[model samples]
Target: MPWILAPRRHRVAAGVAAVLLAACTSVPLPPERPAPVEEVRPTVPHPPAANAVERARSRWVPVDWTELPGWNDDRIAEVWPALRASCGRPAPGWAEVCARAMLEPPADDGTARAWLARWLQPWRVEAPDGQVDGLATGYFEPLVEAVRQPRGEFRVPLYGPPAPGTMAKPGWTRQQFDTLPAAKAALRGREIAWVADPLDALLLQVQGSGRLALTEADGSRRLVRLAFAGHNEQPYKSVGRWLVERGELTLDTASWPAIRAWARRNPQRVQEMLWANPRVVFFREEPLPDPSIGPRGAQGVPLVPGRSIAVDAGSIPYGTPVWLDTTEPLSATPLRRLVVAQDTGSAIVGAVRADYFWGWGADAEAQAGRMKQPLRLWALWPRGARPQ
Candidate 1:
């Protein structure tokens, strides 16, 4: 397969926030607590700083390396590729550090951790109100089976954008696209491929980009990417939240998988369920070059599963190494690791909110769909290069 160039847009799960936030309702979050230090390392503390520096959306409080929870226990070498990936599109004031990183790739976890400690300092990200904790959610790239031309059960179409001037400014709702002649006429002949299930199409659109295992008309199969092209501009509504509100599912059980199960049981109402969300996303087809490489994030670099995260660029710039202290999806097991800020999202607004990118496949989808945990982060920055 050949790699094709495609525009990278914000790859947020359209209604993830609404579903996750609804799940967290009525439950007060526990106060921030640092993980117990398991490894003892001699360290020199920096001289006291004057105070926390305020950014546009958050405050950065300089902190000692030891203050970062579970920092010593992480396999720092695991994140080296992601670190180098960030260096490809280094953020402001990162040229010097990126240059050094390119030349001094570490040999082991110990060396990586040491090299990072020597080159960078850790800053705790907090809200302006001095709160150090926030919510963590998850997103993933969906994989949907498709065909070049509609055949057999493959009736639902994945469309590209409408003719330039045909799209309404705030375009037709999802229902309007299905029922109204003007809306249907506008999108006619824009089909990129066809799939068996409408839910699969929605999954691809919700995540903004996905893989299509396409069987071309010649009967040969190849994987391709369908990148987000544009949207209807209609307001997004959470189908998961809709089910929760109507007593079909509880907050805890309102995951993507659960939603699909509900749709199966109530097949006749599947379209009704989909209509609950007003937005419809269009896509452009792209060639898949390397099966190992993930989709390009907003940073214009391929994402690394388990190592890439979407953050508010204002809170933490793209290419910054972030120490994430959070838990596994729907589990209390601590999941503290080093990840990079390489993407952003519409719902991912605030000082501490994050969307963990769980790559592609069934397990990734499962984790992303259920991951709504509390979070704390420390950005590892080149010494004296902290954004003001």
Candidate 2:
């Protein structure tokens, strides 16, 4: 999470363009039939397929179902919830396809695979330079115990945005918010809750959203979600990268646990480490009606653990099903699967990069912290539908 910026913002690149999928690592279909031409709504015009490869932020090369690595092995039914959730707010070219998805909820793996094959076309995602290889990182919601007000060891405050008429265009940096009297006064009454650890607050901010187990004044407990509301609008910096540059840690050893261990060893410098990243994210508290539901992503849909991915909006539109070809973190175990581009991150740019959402809790934190791996992608667009 420290490596990626907030997942709340949508930062699509300007001037939408399409790139071609690299042929080097792909299994091409026979030339007898060309890839199906995507049909988009008249409002979102598409360049002719012939010229697609020549210009664009990213490109797509249609590949056969067999070309997607481990396409047949995934437990397709596991993706149903995420798929259905995406349909709640279908992308521009997905209304018809989403309608079918909602009407025919596949009950099993085989059925799901067949349904996808019938309605979607898998297109390899590539950079304009035809580069297919990219990086895949991981992020997750951090669940932390908290109190309604600051008390005992719970001193760090989690804030909501300042009132509409009280804030400036660009807000204060983390350092200023902590030390400047004027900046601190601006946020005096905006604290939504308080927590004991600064790192936990940092985690929630970095992930852009998380679940908080709140302890009320009456001693009753309720779980709530703190979703990304707004930010200071300052640039985000990576604390992990900061430690690596300072020789306190190496790139390979700069995981979240490692960072925390370093913080414990140098308690006096914890504030310094936190200040490395000037960005501070504010939150809006929402009721956790269902524990199974994750925080809403930039797409405005609840994310599904292991089934939701944050991608570059310019590279793959939100709600698009993606065939991710990547190995497990720090190992060679194959982790290919079908996921929806239900979210996006500031650092999740380029044609092939993605941030996999691992969900909430301890195990999720561990997995996400270590998940920087090589990746390749295939976007499954609705048949006869083009990228918007």
Candidate 3:
């Protein structure tokens, strides 16, 4: 986890926005029904953590089912896949529940809720100081164009990791890779694909993985998936924050669009913009087994959009079933639901803090960009199970 600074952080351009059901191709999904307008709550940040040990950062407060917001409102069926995925690699204290789940899985919302209630207990997540509210952000899969060879517009190379111990100790920084002869030699023949926009390439590195829409020499298009291979081990710095610190953009205005616009206006500084984050990620090509499945997460399973969440793995393990209470992206309407701890991120570093996976495509991008709100979480632990 090189502070990718993954699978969730990079935001792509809207023109290429669409989900790839498979690695090399996909069919356009039907338009989704428009969401009804609803009142939304304002996003607020939680209090800063005091200097305390990891144990004191979060505490579980036992609560009944009724305590969860919108406990029964979610289409629990959507959650079943993510949870079932977790069954393959259950976190500590989750084996029994996951085994039970595998033996007799739920088929519908009613059945799913009933099943969860019978076997799992909802424990409200909070800090030792009883601070429940925490920061809630959004992340999405960026679909972009690429080429197999470095021809014309596709010049920037997306790389695979060099052999272990290739670079001295922690390896070279992102800025040093292209200029250093040794670094270039080490990365020789490591390209998985090439893309036109350097920003798009950087986004893929930042996001850890993405769908690459390719332009074949035969004048045909193909899509492929790039999974995280490794990183340079350099520290990740936020380019957005870097710009903000230099008074180029405000916190509210430092998004993908804004960042790119600023880059275009100042072309000479584009390299500087990129070099701001020294943590360069490498990628590997992966096969698409199931069209319906997305990329694997920290939980060692596919993630479910709107149902999969990235949390601080220190507080919640990868396979924990959590009931999250938050607002819809860019809306105050409560977006409470059952989510699986399928992934982790560098920035996601608190007990109640979460990064909501908005899935793939245009709709997901729209939602993920504007989503920074307050959140509360309740981990659904196995009945009679306690933290050891």
Highest lDDT scorer = 1
Off by over 4 Å in 3: 1-56, 217-220
Off by more than 4 A, model 1: 1-49
Which of the two candidates, 2 or 3, achieves a greater lDDT against the reference? 2
lDDT for each of the candidates? 0.74, 0.73, 0.68
lDDT of 3 by residue, 1-388 (tens): 1112112432211111222222223212110111111112324434444422234457776778999988878888667767777777667787778778767867788998998899988877776566777767777666878887889877999898887767875889888897889988888888887888888887676666778777767778766777776677787677766787898987666565677788889989989888887777887787654435566666556667777787777777777888988887556799888888867766666677777777667676656656666788998878887742
After superposition of all CA atoms, the RMSD between model 2 and the true structure is 10.8
Clash count for each candidate, listed in order shown: 0, 6, 5
| C-alpha TM-score for every candidate | 0.87, 0.86, 0.84
lDDT of 1 by residue, 40-119 (tens): 12133233337777887888888899898888899888777777877877787888998888789899989999999999
Model 3 quality (TM-score): 0.84
Clashing pairs in 3: 6-207, 7-207, 40-332, 40-333, 41-332
The number of the candidate with the highest TM-score is: 1
